[model samples]
Target: MSLAPRIVLVHRTTEYEELVARHGTHGQAAFFLASRGRDIEEVAERSRRTRRALDEIAAGIPLTWRQARVERADLDRFLFAPEDVVVVVGQDGLVANVAKYLAGQPVVGIDTDPGRNPGVLVRHRAADAGALIASAVSRAGAVDELTMVEAVADDTQRLLALNEIYLGAAGHQTVRYRLGRDDDRGAVEPQASSGVLVGTGTGASGWLRSVWQERGGGLVLPGATEERLVWFVREAWPSPVTGTSLVAGHLSVGARLQLTVESDRLIAFGDGMEGDAVELVWGQTVRVGVAGVRLRLVG
Candidate 1:
């Protein structure tokens, strides 16, 4: 007789008792439980239930708890087995860690964002709670050896979205730059003043906010609906005027035209990531593109 296919269920906390209770004996499987050392009590309780269920399902089957050496190798073992299925239960951070460890595998994450993880099935608690959307966007470019997955929202169909990327300064001050083209390629022109901002639909919310805040916190690009655009300014400054006065001054850009920041401590952040120090001068083209990789997910 052929044995049932194996499934590996990974739980982060003790609350996953219900999960083990329901699906523990449904098939031939193993349970891998771990914790980030954040909540010990929860981990203890969950570990007990998970072990009980696993023991009940398959007598004398191996049960492994969180150990130092179980890092990526253990994850690889689960994936290399064609007869095995890995189910991860945790938040986006935990999901990302597992996905990174598994890299290329027919694995799935439960209750987390599926962004940046290709060829993986992601189920979100938002979907289980009847929310209309269940999707995570990764502005942090592509990783090696992965492909995009089909996404499924709560009570919605599966779909895919393009990757979004961005780069910007860190502080509330303005970093000036010029706009033009590079080798016939449309690029920011040669100039200096405050800072520059480049972003996509996914990154607009993050990098865009810094620029917006420096520009007196008004609507960005008043008449432009372009989702992908870069802003190059020669000068920027934080508003010091009180309430309505600042609003009035912000609405009237006469004062902003003369204000400029002069500091070499400017930093670049992409997808909310603070990058290493790299010299950026006039006419230097910082290329941002829709990476040739796609991320996929399943309900």
Candidate 2:
């Protein structure tokens, strides 16, 4: 008989939990929120709903299948097996957080509150998890392959971002770097900018969309499943030492955008998660490209 596939349920901390963790107590959190004219009960209600959804999903799993529950914060330390099916039971950002850690594993995005939260990534309700789990285990579910972006530093430090990768300074200061494309024949342009944004098709609708809109929609981005990626340089400042001509472009499959850091410190972060990132000092070269692995998202 074939072995039962392992199901990994991923979630995030609720507002109430975050408040309590910050303030050290429920009463202190309530007092702090009240001072800010926020009602603690609203957070409480949201937390209660999330708990109910989690309970329903837990109960729906079959007795024969092995199960594991993990929080978004703990995903870096979590070990995901080849046969594991990941189920993210939170907002769309939670799905992005879990996507980088996975390879070819099928993921089911379950929106805890479909009414309040935009279910762009998390499109399914908790009640449908059982059926989805069965389909995933049997490898019978329709999967949407989402492209991902990767940033590899000269030191071999690497990061995989499901949405986009932001490369810039640690503060709101100017970033100095030389930008060049792999296909460019020895031509590189030094640029001084606020930062650089490299986004995959999955991130086209998020940060990339806002940037594209600000530029008068001149550039048409690829779809979420497309293997192509778009990049933009934020607030590029032109000077004798730097240029702004190479500010935006597209990266096809197997193509890479290279940057040589001239500043004292530059940080590279993926999917807007700054806490989990890599730091590149002066004289380091980082390459941003399309990652080989694709996120297998189940509808």
lDDT tens digits, residue span 183-213, model 1 = 3344223334344443323333444556567
Candidate 2: 10-residue stretch with minimal lDDT: 111-120
Model 1 CA lDDT for position 5? 39
What residue runs in model 1 are displaced by over 4 Å at the alpha carbon?
1-89, 92-109, 112-122, 125-173, 181-197, 200-268, 275-284
- Best prediction by lDDT: 2
Task: After the best TM-score superposition of candidate 1, give how far the Cα of residue 24 lies from its true spot, in angstroms.
Answer: 36
Candidate 2: residue pairs that collide = none
> What lDDT does each candidate get?
0.33, 0.90
Residue 72 C-alpha lDDT in model 2: 85
Best by TM-score: 2
lDDT of 2 at 112: 82
Indicate the TM-score of model 2. Answer: 0.96
